[model samples]
Target: MGLFITFEGPEGSGKSTQARLLYERLQRLGYPVILTREPGGTRIGELIRRILVDLRHTEMAPTTETLLFSAARAQLVSELVRPYLKTGGIVLCDRYADSTFAYQGYGLGRDLEELQSITTVATGGLMPDLTFYLDLDVEMGLQRKRSARDRLPEPASAAAAFTPHPEWNRLDARDLAYHQRVATGFAELMRRDPDRWRCFVANQPVDLLAEQIFTQVEPMLARIVRLENPR
Candidate 1:
């Protein structure tokens, strides 16, 4: 069977960059690999991505936003992920269900059970074999991005007519209390899924962080090679 690895973190945690590095390393080692991301990775998913990420759609509801994310993920899995995994390709995903749980369930204050149910249905029981959770302070995470870029609607000007922000993005503009809740929620997630998910401090330099990740990944790679070369 193929390996499905996902990188998860708040915006600016460097998950995307690390995911690319891992993909490149695996490719150089002669492993067949597919690199993709959620809210995208398929034609239908790409269309949904625009709806989900556009800063102009500030009126989008929480439930509606969650459903759209689920929809895009369903299409991505059915159209691209499964096919590649069947051929023994290492699938490196930039964000997955964890983002929904952190951003929607915890950050947006949605029902956690409901979010999990919808995600399970969307993914068709497809879970990552391994996940790396890049941990960073919320302020640092935001600093890494310089500005809101992860599907957050731009904050309205003070003089404009009142408009409610979508729940997912509302978290982005929240006070320290809400962001603290998000951080706690992610820590709890890591605690609950320790076997499948590994939490790494993202405060280190990029090269050092990459080395730490490779230390974990190298063993898995060796095991895979052994399996393939079994006498």
Candidate 2:
């Protein structure tokens, strides 16, 4: 099987940046790799992402939010992720089913078992080969998000072609307590499957963090090569 790596963490944790860095690194090494993000990847998934993140959707129920995320994921896996993996290419995803568990199940107080059932159907039992959890203080992460939102250009500006500050969405409008639970949820997930997770302090310097992540990923790539060429 091809390498499937996921980045998970609280808001403003730099998961997306790290995923991109890793994707570039793999490409430089002549490995086939693709970088993608959750809630949006394929055409259908992008539509779902719009609904899921729109700030006006504050009234969206927990179950509805969960299902929407799952729907997007189902489309992403079938259309992109699964097929690419079949060709032995690496996939670097910003988030996956784990975000659903962390945000909906733990943060929103939804039933974990029900979420698990839904995720199983959405992903068709696909799981990440390695998951990097970029650990950060919840309050600090939220503050970073606020600062980022403030830096975005106005909608009418030429630089702002699409939505203005898309990352600052309805989920970011949630309370600090809810985000704290989500962080706790991530911790619980890592504890449950320690072998598949690599936790890192999100406050570290960017280059240092990227090097650390690359060091961990290099061994996994070697393992994949050995598996494909087992004499």
Window of ten residues with lowest summed lDDT in model 1? 159-168
TM-score of each: 0.84, 0.93
* TM-score of candidate 2 to 2 decimals: 0.93
Per-candidate total of colliding backbone pairs:
0, 0
Clashing pairs in 1: none
Model 2 residue 19 CA deviation in Å: 0.5
For 1-231, candidate 2 gives per-residue lDDT tens digits of: 799999999999999889999988788777878899998999999999988887667789999999999999999999999998998889999999999999999999999999999999999999999999999999988898888878975578644443424658888889999999999999999999999999999999999999999999988786443233322
Cα deviation at 205, candidate 1, in Å, is 1.1
> lDDT of candidate 2 vs native?
0.89
